[model samples]
Target: MKVIAYGASTSSTSINKALATYAANLIPGADVTVLDINDYPVPMFSEDKEKEIGQAEAAKAFLDAIATADALVISFAEHNGHYPAAYKNLFDWSTRIDQKVFKDIPAVYLATSPGPGGAQSVLAAAKGSAPFFGGNVKATVSVASFYDNFDLEKGQPTNSAVADEIKAAVAKLNA
Candidate 1:
């Protein structure tokens, strides 16, 4: 199986990125490719920008990546209760090219934050929008108060309950 995973954030040391990597590692015997949203930077989406720049290579590349995935692992990093700028901008660019950006692939969506909300608002937003983008959001994992729950040395959640929840959610995609 081909698992394409990415943290929907651009920060160099993003906790969302760390979560995505850890989740991908749990999918037994699969080829995994982790993507950085920053790699697909396109100008802010706009009719004017579209007319000026024409077709965007980054946008097409993003779509092509999703098209090749047997399953997807995306962990959202919330910024002000929404997707970070890099991810949102890439998403906007891809949607202009094709509204069904995920091309009907099954997906595991996750979110994490230093606070108790666990980036739940963003996860809810992603769940709400996934169908429109052709993403089969099979399962979701949310880790709240990340600093307290996650261990940087172990590269996973320190709390067993939180860790188990993530494992269970990842299992749903494998199915």
Candidate 2:
């Protein structure tokens, strides 16, 4: 399978990106592309800006990346119980080209944080709105206390139960 994975954040050292990459690699022999939101940056969305600039090339490129994917693995990084501004800006621009950003591809959604909440609020929002945006959500995983649960050197969950849970969720893509 060709899986497109990304963390919905612009941070250089994003823990969510690490979690996403680890989860995408679990899909036996799958080819994965991990995207950085910074590479596809767009101006903050506004109707007036849309009128002035028309459709953004960056947004189209973002959609093109998704078009090549057989499945999606996205890990959300919550900013105050919502999407980070950078990702939200990208999404706003991308929707102008195609409302269905995921293009009906099956997806595994994940979220992580160094706290008990595990960025669950944003994950829940993503899962809830996915279908409206043509995302076929197969499963969702949330890793709480990310530093405690994940091993950076090993690039996997340190907790066996969390690792198993991530594996089970990733497996659903082929189902």
Candidate 3:
């Protein structure tokens, strides 16, 4: 299966990116493509911008990535308990290209934070909104205190429970 993974943040050191990449790697026989939202940066989505520039090449690339994926793994970084601006911009542009941005693909939605909440609010919002965009949410994970639960030096999950949960989620998608 082909899996597309991304973090909904532009931060260079995004914990969400780390978590998403780890989760994607867990899927057996899965060919994963990990995307950095920063690379697909487009002018903030405004009706005016759309009218003047039409679809940005970056947005087209993002949509193309989603279109080729069999499954998706997204780890959202919440900004004030909501979607980050970078991610929201990408979502807006992608939807303009394809109303159903997710294209009915199975997905594993995830979130992570240095604090205790672990981006649960954004994760919840994604779970609720995904189906409307043609996504099938197979599993979700919220990793709290990401620095404590993950080993940055090793680039792996240090929390066994969280690792098991991620493995189970991957299995569900693979099934």
Q: Tens digits of per-residue lDDT for model 3 on 1-175?
A: 9999999999999889889999999888889999999889899999999999999889899988888999999999999999998889889998888878888888999999999998999999999988778878999999999999998777788999989988898778877
Q: Which residue pairs collide, candidate 3? A: none
TM-score of 3: 0.97
TM values, all candidates: 0.97, 0.99, 0.97
Candidate 3: stretches off by over 4 Å: none
Q: Arrange candidates by lDDT, descending.
A: 2, 3, 1
Candidate 2, 1-175: lDDT as tens digits: 9999999999998999999999999999899999998999799899999999999889999999999999999999999999999999999899988999999999999999989999999999999999889989999999999999999888888899999999999999988
Residue 124, model 2, lDDT: 99
Residue 137 deviation, candidate 1, in Å? 0.7
